[model samples]
Target: MTFSEKLRELMTARGLGLRELARLAPCDSGYLAHMREGRRIPSAKLAERLDQVLDAGGELAALVPARRARRKTPKGKAGASIARRDVLALAGAAGLPRGLSGPVAPELADYFRDQLAGHYTADRHLGPFRLIPTAAAQYDLLCDLANAARGTLRPRLWSLAAGYAAFLGWLYQDGGNIDRSVYWHDVMLERAHRSNDRQLVAFALHNKAMLHADLLDGQGVLELTRAALQEESALVPKVRVLALQQTAHGISLTEDGDARDECDCLLDQAAALVDQIDDAYPWGGACLTPHYIDIQRATCLVRLGKAADALTLWERIMPSLRAAGARRDAGVFLARQAQAYAVHHEPEHAVTVAGEVVELANATGSERMRRELSALRTRMRPWAKEPPGRQLQELLSSMGGHT
Candidate 1:
């Protein structure tokens, strides 16, 4: 049977309606409806909630998309079932790994080392954005290594786990199982404290600030970002600076002029230090290019209502953003572009860009992106019946959403 079929059967057997299922699962009813209709796939985090609510022996597979479902080969043989167990093993490994085999299998050590660096960098580029399950897999492997080798593991191992936990907290802002992300963050922070690694602490705080930003808790963002900046060392790694910058950007959203000014100063400091620091390379996932900076500046300009300036920056940065396979990032830039166009009273342009935003948001299953697009739709509402307003409304309605 298909995953959705299983879900339908389970719900019926349990005497639950769609709304009741959504209530028990703690997600939007529409989101649940979409899943039931096979129009949407539940996130790993969401599946876990459904598992508990349905009392399905923690079998999340019953709700996985049909495409992701395990295949049964022969009755006596196990294929995907074993694969699923391996997947679970890896997840459990996130709690703790056996240990870093020093004299380690060169390949194993290399994988852990590479994974650690990759996750840290990935955290930077995502900018507190929650990651999909595939992306989270990287951190889980590194976490396993850290957990398995308590005393024998290198200090960097602890840093890796803490950094990953911090990233997880940012990515799964609303839907994640708290036990792994937030709870893990607390553990990571405590570990960082024990290690007395201020850089790691700062990085973790920056991530926590992003989580607060996701919650629209601007005060929390400011408080945590400030703490992170305080702990950031002049000689900190470049990725660490990027982490701080993400928090600074979050602070900019608070409309605090003083915090904004301070953030600017810190940006300048980061830039100046960028040239002087040796080996202060971009973390693999967090590579900051001139274009990335321009995008960041443009975002700030938009929030500051410097629409013309933001437009100029967007025009210049669009080529590179599109070239980087940064579809999600591009989608965001387009959403902002739509907003800037609306602010400038260019409805036609706003309509064009908003279309791009909705398309990308839908493709990525990004509710956050959809929310931003929804806000743009609201701003465009007063001009109803116009091509722009009609375009926005049509897109929202198609998504089964409203402003």
Candidate 2:
């Protein structure tokens, strides 16, 4: 696609207006309009900034040609000949050749692992649109390392690759790109097994199970969670608890009274297991806190038609969420709380909470949050003519009708 077309497509996907993109890119909106009309071409620098602003994954930048001062390298790429020569001189002074300065897989692995933690933090606080490109670039670099690594470094590199793949799968899922998510999960499973990282293998399986849960595949959720739990060694506390929780969720979706009993029992067991988590280990449990489990439990309660119980639990959980993690998740929970209130006929409370959810969704540009809140609005349709309901409808409309 032409640079203009790609930019437009990305803006639409990310729900950005031309002025919004231009303002965020710190460029002239008129220049952008002219570029779209093919009257003017974007400079490479502008293309790069646009790519970053739109999270286009370099799509815009790739379509633009570099001005030749011989040739220009993009940011994060090799510098000019002078820079390379300076680097070579420094390496010579250090008694190490330029070639010998190539990446050490162990170091690369550690770097990727550390970066993964930062990526996770970003995932919590930033929307997928802001971070997906960075995540993909990190994964691509890890793949390059995996190809060149040998022996111990090779396995280590693969382990890190698997980690990034799993992370990419999650990023894609949050971005509502399910096909990419499935592809990355399968890649994660393969690489995890190849690297013999038992913990990661279990993690990948549990991730797949959670995906199945999202897809409303109760049986698939059960199967994958069980497979995760059946790993040879004892799984990490968080991983084990997650599997148990997924199993409970899967069972809760079924109509069997006996399964519901099992669901409750599993949840109780999972709660008790939380105390066993060791803080010293680098546990990947960003969403596995006691509070998170309680939130999940509340969701199950609502699923079981116990909206009042869910409302009580939501109230208890609300005070603790200090806007620390994903705005998307926070917005989602707020919408759920609003739903609980709505279902319980607390129109004022529902409308007030829905307003908070919608505002957050708008601020963060989180489609997932918008979708959840929109569903809540639909659920409140019977009360649409009520004062609170009418207020919420107006609020949603003012925020751009479609979720």
Candidate 3:
């Protein structure tokens, strides 16, 4: 059922009215009513309050989709024929390079749309680096389109081009191509700057900083995060909260006394704004929770040599981590798990987890994960005399069964 329908059904079951629920929720009745009717989406804050009022389970009250009748598709042989033709047309025209006439040749635009759809479909078919050519072609097309546009079309084309660049950057990052990711990120940033779009610029800067954070660059992380937070007036409150989170991540890595203190204060402010903040979750991942904060806090504890405290926090958060689909991408998440385990002197568990990660990395042929696994093995090399460590080293060299 949709959130609205669920809300209505739950209220009726309890013999409660909208006004009563609103009073208990301590939010505006009109807003609650609108939410019930699907006229509006409740902010996280509002949803939390309503969930409390309803004595509901978790934050999933809004996750249910209202039931709707599925539309019937044509099912005759002729329908299949038409579908085949449409697919062929889409495939034939998608991803063509643009011409010099300024506007992306219509064929080129068609090509871009096709490539985007293809990129998402049957992802295993294409390798990560293939996106480089696809993205480069689209970028050229967008530039031509921008140059060709006059008056109204000009701004629209520019926006499309900028958005396309941002998408390319996202693809590169997800594909584990950091160098290419930054290149496109820079392109997107420049486009956003040229377009005078503060929000877009904020997005670009935040994403760029995120890439650096992923690489564990302390100074780079701090610098870019500061740049993100510096535009206080220009950023929405939610964006500001994210900048704070990024700053916190950087501080966790640095182990600086003053910076750690500042991050603690910043996190305190972030926690207060939690309910008030709009959606600023990165990558739509479940890590966008208080649990994620706890995980980072745990990491900080580990860096501070408070292994006992860190271990407690890790144990607490592991369930959430498991629930967050960490097992699905066993290559990376398992490696991270191994890292956590290794640092805590649980070499046996780390070795076991590393084995699983290496197997997945080999299966996926992900050099990125393989590299990470290698690094972890090197760290555990000191324990080479131990059977588990020795086994881990051998596992690292040839992740696949060939060795």
The candidate that wins on lDDT is: 2
lDDT of 3 by residue, 1-403 (tens): 5667667877887788876886676543545675688544554555666777776674335453222222233455222223333433443455323334433334434444455445433233333443444444455555655676555555545555665677667556655656657777898788877656565567667777767776877778888878877767777656666677777778877878676576677776655555665542222122345465666566555545555666677667666555654332435545655666777788898788787777656555554566557656755766889987888877877655322
Candidate 2 residue spans exceeding 4 A from truth: 1-103, 258-260, 279-283, 287-290, 323-326
- Per-residue accuracy of model 2 over 159-250 as CA lDDT, tens digit each: 77888788878766765556767988999999989888777788888889877766767889888888888863477677777778888888
Off by over 4 Å in 3: 1-140, 149-160, 170-177, 258-260, 267-306, 317-330, 365-368, 400-403
TM-score of 3: 0.59
lDDT of each: 0.60, 0.71, 0.60
Backbone clashes for every candidate come to 4, 0, 7
- lDDT accuracy of residue 208 in candidate 2: 90
- The clash number for model 1 is 4
Question: TM-score for each prediction?
Answer: 0.69, 0.73, 0.59
Superior by TM-score: candidate 2 or candidate 3: 2
Which window of 10 residues has the lowest lDDT sum in candidate 2?
A: 78-87
Write one digit per residue (lDDT tens) for candidate 1, span 276-301: 43542212234345565566666666
Q: Find the candidate with the highest TM-score and give its number.
A: 2
